[model samples]
Target: MECQVKANPQVKEVVWIHDGRPIHSFMATGNVEDSEKGVDSDLNQYQSVLNQRYRYDHHYQQQQGPNHHGSTIIMTNQSLVIQKVHRSHRGRYQCVALNDQVVPGCKANQKHQYGVSKNEQIRIRCEVDAEPTDDLTFRWTLNTSGTETAIEWPSFTIVNKTISIATYRPESSLDYGTLACSAQNKIGIQERPCVYSVVPAGRPDGVRGCAITNHSMNTLLIECLPGDDGGLRQHFNLEVYYGPNESRSSMKVLSEASAQSKSFSSSSSSSIVFDNQGVSAIQHHQQLRLHSNHSSSQPNFLVSSLTPGTTYTLNVYAANAKGRSQTVSLSAMTLASPEKHVARARDSETKLTFFFASEQEASNKSLYIRFLPY
Candidate 1:
């Protein structure tokens, strides 16, 4: 490969070296006729190499103009091209112009934006290019809020010559900010910066202790304990199904039912049961209610306008910054009104027998004996 290096009159001699060993050298004495004689450098050490334009100038008219009287001269294209480049040649190389005049060059890939999470490990690589590459050293820094902080050894590990890896734990005060890698030599230092952002969280854990509490003919109360909030604030949603059963078809009907009669009670602990018999039965009414705004401290919900004597399957789900959790379901049936049972008992002949029904006697055998005036 051909490598062209610029040259100035002050550059009396130019030497091509790889890995601190000389490959070729060109000595300039300011004369074009002596250019071929000045190439006294060795090339047979590794491979065949050549040099061009290394001589001293005696007269100005012979080179540029008849009247140009300058002691020093400037040479344009000074190149060193290799034939059939080999993998072994891929290493630090330098084109030394005048022994003590050091020149530095910087190289690095373009910085890109990366998405990361808390406590994640990341690797960054940067490169430094300079004449006499061994003269340079590299280090990294972090920029936070316009403040620059140098990276230390144990906190970040160096990989090979140009790469480094570090683990970022946001909990630590030192881990947050943009990253920059700097290359420094005797001449100067150059740097490259990278950008990154944190990714969103995942779904939270499920809620616990989800169960139905006290209820009247038209309202029901439910309570639950929220689990892990996925590192963010959480809210709740309650879905009620009151169709034939837990089948998908019944759930579809429940999904279509309007919640115009549904509402949340201001009381922390309350019940929900429907006063309208048509809406209370499984065959006639299906309703789905949602309650979004509630305090995490008090997870008790008072659902209103529910049907009496009808069973409902209620599901409570919690949501946070990430997503919603799996639903917790509970079933409860509202109690039938006592006034109808009292009316039926008055219509019966034996007052003692009329006081109790077969279904009621089977469920609750303990009778409260109360005497009424004759």
Candidate 2:
């Protein structure tokens, strides 16, 4: 509260809310023209109960400085003249006439900020001095290249002190463009980026889909789901384990960016039952093989039947923008028989379907039918 309000001393009072509650009633009383003389005008002035009571209540007798009011003084101005002042004078002030009248309070001078961990995990927050105590808010945006460009750490907060906040990243924002979060108060605010650089992750943060099926006792056609952002990767390897022994015996398909189905076919014939209550089953073969860059429609094999009934483990790795990712391991056991299955033929392909074995193998999210050469 510094500038002297340009008032004809006509308005009765001004009101503002605080902590979900309204300020107590106030009014300025007495005459207005001789305000400098400390006398209220006959027009009737508004007054507010200062934190302290004026020692000399008889208008002309009360001291000009602060009074002993109920609330603590946040600021104090000792300057008698309104214009000849410095920053040190503003403090808890109370004006009492017959009614309460005043200008907007000092709540319009605060700000807030936020932060995040790896993977764009975030924590939004804000901070400032203090006014009448209100709330705050924040917002963010992205750039065309999919980079987070701007941010308003906290949205619109109506407060001045420290602001508390929490936010979550959209599970689907693979693009991760420029983002901004803005923290707003009554009339003032501050902002920051949700992320400084909207750097596209070299490796896709999302990718899923790879299950096993049975067409033959020795072949396992595993359909894999690839990522759209990352095309082909560099440096890939696979490990196959037969029974308790380790070996390499499956073909690798490097062209898959989304869903893929490759089979591990072997010449040996036997039978290897599945476990995990059919949730998953692995076939072990004596060998592992990588297919010769097949056509677009060919299945990517992890193991090509070097020996049937032998268990094996597959370790896969792909290149990413950040660098190289650790290999992912999958377990598989070659079938006991030689009935190797492949792709399916459908006149009306409803969903992505693969021909494995018996209709019982069909999945809810996918179709696994093992029948004639579709």
Candidate 3:
């Protein structure tokens, strides 16, 4: 950043100001040295002069355009490019002609903070081209990329050599790179950066789901589209939330099925049958047992016999290469046992007339009757 300021010619001396503060001033005008030599005064001498004569001041705040009427710096260079810069070089700046003795420095430079996305652990970093001894300050901007213009200074920091900031959620992931980090001191300002990205603990996303179905008093088994065709295996983890309370749920690990592993990526559409894969189990009221799958040994669970009268709620979630399906909920209720049948037999000396009583137990189906000698 840089600029040029014209001399007043009548003022005798020239001075630069930023936001009502003095940048620098010179004693009288026409200060250019006509006779200078020695390859522009050795690099070391030039460095010494720059450090002593032009050290920047960090206390001044930036002034918006329409600010202070005119350009402030007297600059001969096209642009002010700082190399290996640090966080101490941030804020609005101006260059003014100080009696033709020095050129103005640069244009205003703004800085931003860096951070991770929401629900994420990754962190961002900052760097600059300054001495380690410079006492740098930091300021961050939030909601920089929203629909509305959210760019703001909001606050600033002054302390040790560096600043580490951890932003809270809702304020963390603002959708774009709008946040600015301003590092300031008496001479200049530099800003560090922050980026936001959320990552779950496991499986890329740590949301685990489940569902129970097909129940008998002894067990409950779930039939899912196979995830692993014998080539792959999976287990069901059940965390039961009982009654009406949600947080009161206890974790119950249902059994796993070890069918032979087969991959869905195999060139066959049938390889994708496990698209119905899900977690399953059998409680004391519902038990899940490994059953023989003559079809393809693709591990499928069996729900065993269950108790009558009790209502059981089963929730099932299915997942595969495509993605996880929504949870499926079901209920099972047991029925009462059937009574045995009794009949009178005909005696050898007496002919007996038989009367039939109607009791429906799968009576829509027919039954066979036979007589044998005692």
Candidate 4:
């Protein structure tokens, strides 16, 4: 029996299967002299059972010389020469050609965590990247309570030969666990499976590391580090509130000065109000809401039309389908605009000098003087 295979990239190996099992293998080392030595050990046992009556030969042919080719022609032949025909050899035979084999790498197309409610069906997509995409197969498994159960066909559908979507419904607490997907091709099965966690949806975690990144006379740029989404999509909200400075004297003066100004009310439950005696009636300035299907690692909010030299409190909250997270608070003050200054120079002097106060005494501020001849 002879089997021939022709492939690009050069065939790396040839395997002979009999009765749905591998009976012999040959490593196509590309060297004609080493063809006999490439026979794998798997053929030894089979040959012994046949009393060494079978002779195996691997033949490689190159139709044209290396330098004289329009296209290099390569072919491999695996022949099982039987000295005498026997009834035991009457079985199906096949030859498989293999180039470089690649193990499939699978990953969940959706978020790492999936939110599910009881009796709600969710379709999770798994994608695989591998070489030789033909004949690829996928396997899904559900692991719950230390027992892994294999999910058979009809539960999942394959699309475009590389993506598989598995339909799963969580009817009880036991159904909320981990779903893993693995893939295999003619080469081998994937070593690691793509995993996704299923859990009850809830509010997202509060934002962290809130800080005033940029501050001007009329605008404040606030940035915060995002947190987990609690197995759901999350958005961010920023609320700005202004009140008297933390100083007792400052609060008293501002309250009295602004007593005649229009008063504003806030519907936020977490609003902080300050009274006349420096007790923290904060007026809600404005609210900015950002909606995003995917949250970034660091989200920034720009609050404009702010009052200069006034201290304001900013609250950031993350909201999801379930609810909103706890408020993360940050206090920031916009820079005061510079006041006009007039300077007079002496008759004999060619330039006038001016001075400004530095907010922090320990700050390393510099002054530069450039004199141009008139």
lDDT, candidate 1, 99-130, per-residue tens: 33333333545433333345655554444445
**Alpha carbon lDDT at 234, candidate 3:** 24
Number of the top-ranking candidate, with TM-score as the measure? 4
**Which ten residues in a row are the worst by lDDT in model 2?**
53-62
* Count of clashes, each model: 20, 122, 83, 6
Q: What is the lDDT of residue 259 in candidate 3?
A: 41
The residue ranges of model 1 lying beyond 4 angstroms of the native Cα positions read: 1-200, 246-298, 340-374
Better of 2 and 4 by lDDT: 4
Error of 3 at 64 (Å): 45
Residue 124, candidate 2: C-alpha displacement in angstroms: 34
Write one digit per residue (lDDT tens) for candidate 4, span 80-136.
443223344345655555555466776445566789788988898889886667899
- As a TM-score, model 3 comes out at 0.23
**lDDT (CA) for every model shown?**
0.48, 0.35, 0.34, 0.61
Global lDDT for candidate 4?
Answer: 0.61
Q: How accurate is candidate 1 locally (lDDT)?
A: 0.48
Q: Cα deviation in Å at residue 344, candidate 4?
A: 21
Task: Count residue pairs with overlapping backbones in model 3.
Answer: 83
- By lDDT, the candidates rank as 4, 1, 2, 3
RMSD list, candidates in order = 23.8, 22.7, 24.7, 14.3
Query: What lDDT tens digits, residue by residue, belong to model 2 across residues 1-374?
Result: 32122334333343221211222233122111122242233212122322221111111122233332222222122112233232322333333322222112222332222222235555434333322234544444434343445333333333334443344453444544434434444434442323333333455322234455442445555444444333222233334344443322323233431122234222332113222123223333433343222121212343455456544454444444445444344555565433322222334356654565665665535735665533
> For residues 241-325, could you state the per-residue lDDT of candidate 3 as single tens digits?
1222111122122233214223322233211111112333222222322222212132244544554433444444433322333
Q: TM-score of every model?
A: 0.30, 0.24, 0.23, 0.50
